[model samples]
Every structure is written in structure tokens, then in C-alpha cells.
Target: MGEIKYKRILLKLSGEALMGKQNFGIDGDVVKFIASEVKEAYEMGVQIGIVVGGGNIFRGVSESAKGMDRVSADYMGMLATVINSLALQNALENLGVPTRVQTAIEMRQVAEPFIRRRAIRHLEKGRVVIFGAGTGNPYFTTDTAATLRASEINADVVLKATKVDGVYDADPVKYKDAVKFDAITYLEVLNKGLKVMDSTAISMCMDNEIPIIVFDLFGKGNLKNILLGKKIGTLVEGKHD
Candidate 1:
């Protein structure tokens, strides 16, 4: 294997990536594809932790959730994340990768409650750890939860798996002349209001000194390529050249 740039990583997967072509909910094929990608990374001996969003299943702030009590809707959204986490777990295990699902909410029946020491132990033992249910708090985005968990685990970096290849000045899909950055600083991301991640998430990563890589999750081999230090995505860190 080539030199591994990062030994431990937190992978932030958006729920919508699991939707594939469906209107909502998990798509079996997409989950399998993602599992395959992650499996390849695990084979390279990279310790992995995942934080999955619930947008595909439900979103507390979306129009579909309008008129509902804010806290109630957010709790429902947290449940959605558990469902997604379980699905991804099943997929990874089916491919012969040892995996565990840890939830922020205490649902002992489905998965273990989030524990910092136990999670670190799992990674040391060569098992992949998946974090679900956000921060178990209302109004906190899953993005923030991912950063928080990364910080606790002392992750080397946060790999944000998105549909886009990297961070752009504008929506590349909507604007034809969007410019991409090879690397950017956290302060620039906040000062320019770039949407690589939510403000809270970005701030937490900055404070913790964890670099963030925004990359195209759908690109086959991209995950492994990143571990090999090929620079497949936009790097967001404390400083840039």
C-alpha cells in the first residue's frame, strides 16, 4: 500500500447519498456501493468512523416537517439517522467488514449508546464504528455531530462525502463558471460563508485542528485515493499555500 496520509478518519455521509434515484429512504444499491468503497479503505488499514445524516429519511427543518413541534420533529429526525446507520451497518457486515453502530440516543435494543472509550477501542481492534442519531439534541445538524465525534476520537481528519467533487465558489450545477479550490483555510470558509459544512461544524473542526476534505463520494476509488494522498478533493485546514 502507498503511504497513508491519515491513519484515522471520520467520514461524514449525507443521507441523500443513500437515496440514489429514489424519492426518499435508503436505496439498497447505493448503500452497497458505499459499503464497497468503505470496505476498500478498511482493507488499507485506515481506522474509520462514520456520521450519517437523516435528510433522506426526514428533515426537521424541511417543508415536510412544517407545523410540527420543533423538538418533536428533531427527535423524529434523529430516529431517521439510526435507521440509516443500521442499513449501512448491514451492508458493511455483509461484505465481511466488522462494523458497529453507536447512537447518540440511548436505544440499547438497536445499538450501543455513544461512548468515547469504547468507540476508540473498536477502532483499535480493527472494527469500523458508525455514529448515528446526531448529537441527541434538537436543532443541531448532523454535520456538527460529525465534527464533535471526530474531536472526541482525536481523528486525523474529517472526510465529508458529498455529491460534489469539492468546494466551489458557487453551486457548480447551477453556475457554469464556478471555480474550485485545491485548498482553503477554515477562516476563509467562514468569512466567505462557503457551504462546505454548517458554521458550527466548521468551527468545531477549526478549534480541534482537524482538517476537512470535501470530496465526491460517488466517485469510485476516490476514498482510497485520498488515503494515498493523491489530493482528490478540496482540503480545508488551518492554513493554506
Candidate 2:
């Protein structure tokens, strides 16, 4: 295997990535594809932790949350993440990869409660640990949860899997001349108000000294390629332009 920039990493996947062509919920094919990509990385001796969002199932902070209590809507979103986590766990296991699902919200029947040491142990044992439920608190995005976990687990980096290939100056879909950065710094991300991740998430990662790679998850081999140290996405770090 080629040298990997990060020996251990946290992968952040949005719920929409699991939708594939479907309008809502998980798509079996997309899950399988993601599982395959993760498996390839696991085979490279890279320890992996994954955080999945619930936007595809239901976004608590979105327009659908109208008329609902903010806390209530966020709790519902957390549950949706658990559902996605379980689906992903099933897919990875089906492909013969040992995986564990840990949730911030206690649901012992389905998954173990999130414990930092236990999660690290799972990674040491060559198992993929999937974190769900968004920090067990309302008003926090899964992106924050992922960054927090990465810091706790001492992950070398956080791999943000998005539909877009990299962080752009503007929404590529909306602007034909959007500029993509080959690399950027956390301060720039904040100063320029780049939508790489939520401000809270980016700040946490910056404070913890963890770099982030934003890439297109749907692209074939993108995950594995990034793990292998290929420049397949935009790198956001503490320093450099």
C-alpha cells in the first residue's frame, strides 16, 4: 500500500449521500458502494471512524422543522442518524468488515453508547467505528460530533465526504465561475465564510489541530484515493494558503 497521509481518520458522510437517486431515506446501492470504499481503506491498515448525518431522513433545523420546538426537532434528527448508522453498519458487516455502531443517545438494544476509550479500542482492533446521534444534544450538527470524536480519538484528519469535489469560493452549481481551492487554512475558511463545514465544527477542528479533506463521496475510488495520500480534494489545515 502507498503511504497514507493519515494512519487513522474520521469520515463524515451526510445522510443525503446515502440517498443516491432516491428522494428520501437510505439507498441500498449507495450504502453498498460506501461500504466497499471504506473496506478498501480498512484493508490498507487505516483505522476508520465514521460520522453520518440524518438530513436525508429528516433535517431537524430545516424548513420541515417549522412549528416544532427546536429541541424536539433536533432529537428527531438524532434518531434519524441512528437509523443511518445501523444501515451503514449492516452494509460493512455484509462485506466482511468488522464494524461497530455507537450512538451518543443511549439505545443499548441497537448500539453501544458512545465511549471514547471503547471507540479507540475498536479502531485498534481493526474495526470500523460508526458514530451516530450528534453529541446526544440538540442544536448541534453531526459535523460538530464528527470533529469532537476526531479530537477524542486523536485522528490524524477528518475526511468530509460531500457531493462537491472540494471547497469552492461560491456554490459551484449556482455560479459557473466558482473558484476551487487546492488547499486552504482554517482561519481563511472562517474569514471568507467558506461553507466547508459549520463554524463550530471548523473551530473545534482548528483548536484540536486536526486537518480536514473535503471531497466528492460519490466519485468512484475517491475515498480510497484520499486515504492513499492522493490530492483528490481540498485540504484545510492550520497553515498555508
Candidate 3:
């Protein structure tokens, strides 16, 4: 393996990324592919912690939440994240990678409750830890959960896996001339109102001085490339580049 830039990383995957080409729900093939990518990373000796979203299965903030109690909808979304986390855990284990699924909510039968010390221990034991249930709080995005976890675990950086390759000034898909930033500051991202991550998530990372790499999860080898210190995505740090 190439020289790893980060000793530890928090990988944030959207629920939609697990969907593959499917309209909804998890796609088995995509999960397997992602698992293989993660396995490669685990082999590199870099500790990994993962936070996956539930938008594909159920979005807490979507229209479906309209008229329903906000807390209730968010709880439902948390459960959705648990489903994705379990699927990912199964995939990683199938590849012979030791993995643990920890949820913010107490799902004793399925996964262990989130415990910082236990999670770090898992990483030290060469096991990948997957965090699910979005912080066990309503109105908080999985992105926030990722930053929170990364901070608690002292991860070198948070790798946000998105469909887009990097952070662009505008929507690259809609505007042909949109420009992408090779790197940016957290304040710039917040001041410019860049949607790379939600405000809460970005602020938490900023306050903690943690770097974030937003990259395309759909691109083959992108995750490995980033882990190897290749400039495969936009790097957001405390200072601009």
C-alpha cells in the first residue's frame, strides 16, 4: 500500500451511495464493492470509523415528515440508518474484515450501543467500527454525527463520500462552467454557504480543527486514492489553499 496520509479516518457515506443504480433500498452489488474498497483501506493499517446516512431508506427531513411530529420522523430516520449500517457490517464481515456496528440508540439485539472507549478499542484491534442512528437525537443529520464521532475518536480527518467529485462553486451538474476548489477553509465553506456539508457538521469540524475530504464515492478507487494521499477530492481544512 502507498503511504497513508492519515493514521485514522472517519468515512461518511450517504445512504444514497449504497443505493447504486436502484431507485431505493440497498443494492447488494454496490455494498460488496464498497466493502472491498473498505477492506483495502483496512489493510493499509489506517483505523477506520464509518457513519452512513439513511436518506435512501428514509429521510427524516423529507416531505414524508410533513404533518408528522418532527421527533417521531427523525427517530424513524435513525432506524433507517441502523438498517444501512447492518447491511454494511454484513458486507465487510463477508470479506473477512472484522467489523462492529454501534448505534446511538440501544439496539441490544442487533448492535452495541455507541461507546467511545469501546469504539477506539475496536479500531486498535484492527476492526472497522460503523456508527449508526445519527447521534441518538432528532433534528441532527448524519453528517453531524460523523463529525462528532470523528472528534471523539480523534480521527485525522473526515472523508465525506458524495456523488460529486469535489466541492464546486456551483452545481457542476447544472452549470458547465462551475469551478471546483482544490482546497478550502471551513469559514469559506460556511460564509459562501457551500453545501459540501450542513452548517452544524462543518462548524463542529471547524471548531475541532479537523480536516474534511469531500470526494466522489461512485468513482472507482476514489476512496483508496484519497487514503493514499492522492489529490482525488477537495480538501477542507482550517486554512485555504
Candidate 4:
């Protein structure tokens, strides 16, 4: 119940995270659990924006790019994100949390089109705005979209909810002795080439001076802990000492 350090935050959730233990697609129970967790933060008066990936349903670059245009494949991936966003919006509303799904690609019948001013207004009204469609451009990952939206929304931080608790020197899943960092600078992340996020996303955040906290969302209370300014994850920021 500590004071929330961030008035508004952009949360980046990987589509794979929504799958839980399932091989693909979203797991209903898992989405519900995440929705509940988001509700906890929302009730505490913290404005939340979400950017979700579509790896669970499709990875266009890897799947349909056999002979098709790369840009077209990427657009398909963006559409997949919109599907995920709608699903999450449904889940959050079922939990009684006010939510909005805004897509870069306008689908008026389903959700709002991405509008920075409108999104900010929604946040001021205490509604959670979910951003989908990955910047509405091809060759951009959801990570970059999260960073871009975080900057546009003037969020205090980008909370990257991942499977691992923090960034590591090597792949923790494969490297048993990988060292986890409690805190790090943007330069360190870039220099070491740690896969905490794509370089484009990291650079965008660094340039905007937006701090990113990498933490495991599956751990109960981790998001709450981070919002309360407790040290629960690896924080990457600009020009750290």
C-alpha cells in the first residue's frame, strides 16, 4: 500500500505470456488473472496503458513471409495484435475494470482508433487504454510500439512484464549461470546486447528518458511492488551512474 511512484505507466505484455502453459493462443484463466492484477493497480489510481504482442496467434515475419512481401506479413502481425487487444479488453471488462482498445489500424466497429489525445483523456478518466497494431507500420515489433506509445502518452515508466524477473547477461533459460542485473543503464544494455528488448525499443526509451522496469508478471504482487517504488526488478534508464 505504498504511494505509487508513477502516475501513469505503459505496460508491455508479450503474447506468449498470455498463453501461460498453453502451446498457443490465450489461456482464459491466465488472462483473467492478469486482468485481476491490472484491476488492483487501477483501483489504486494509477493510469495504465498496455501494448501487447501477437506471437501467440501469429508471427508474420516468421510464418507468412516465405514468398510474400515482408511489409504485408508485418501488417498481418499488427492485425493479430488487435485481436489480442480485443480479447484483453473483454477480459478486463468482465473483471469490472473500464477498458479501451485502440488500434493503429482503425476498426471503428470494434474499437477506437489510436488517438494520442483521446487516449490521454481516457487515462485521465481512469480507464485502461490498450494499444494494439504495433505502431500501424511494418517492421516494427510490439516492443517498439510500447516504447513509442509510452513516450506519446507521457508515461512515467514502461513496465515490461516478462517470464524472467530481470535482464540477464545471457539467456537464463539456457545459461544456468547467467547473471541477473538488479539495475542497469541503457548504455550497458546496448553495449552488452542483452535481449531484454529489441534494440529499437531500448533506444527509443533511452532517447525519451523513459525508464523501463523488467519483471516477471507471473510472480504475485510484482507489478504492485514495482508501482509502489519497491526494488523488485531490473531498472534500465538513461545515463545511469
Q: Which has the greatest TM-score?
A: 1
lDDT of 3 by residue, 1-241 (tens): 7788999999999999999989899999999988998998898888999999999888978887888898999999999999999999999999999999999999899999999999999999999999999999998999999999999999999999988999999999999999999999999999999999999999999999999999988788888888889998899999974
Query: Per-candidate TM vs. native?
Result: 0.99, 0.98, 0.98, 0.97
Per-residue accuracy of model 1 over 34-134 as CA lDDT, tens digit each: 99999999999999999999999999999999999999999999999999999999999999999999999999999999999999999999999999999
Worst 10 residues of 1 by lDDT: 17-26
How far is 23's C-alpha from truth in model 4 (Å)? 1.6
Provide the overall lDDT of each model, using Cα atoms, as 2-decimal numbers: 0.96, 0.95, 0.94, 0.92
User: What is the C-alpha lDDT profile of model 2 across 89-120, one tens digit per residue?
Assistant: 99999999999999999999999999999999
Worst 10 residues of 4 by lDDT: 57-66
Model 2 lowest lDDT segment of ten:
1-10
Which residues of candidate 2, in runs, are more than 4 Å off?
Answer: none
Model 4 stretches with alpha carbons more than 4 Å out: none
* RMSD of candidate 1 to true structure, Å: 0.6
TM-score of 2: 0.98
Candidate 3, RMSD to the unseen true structure: 0.9
Clashing pairs in 1: none
TM-score of 4: 0.97
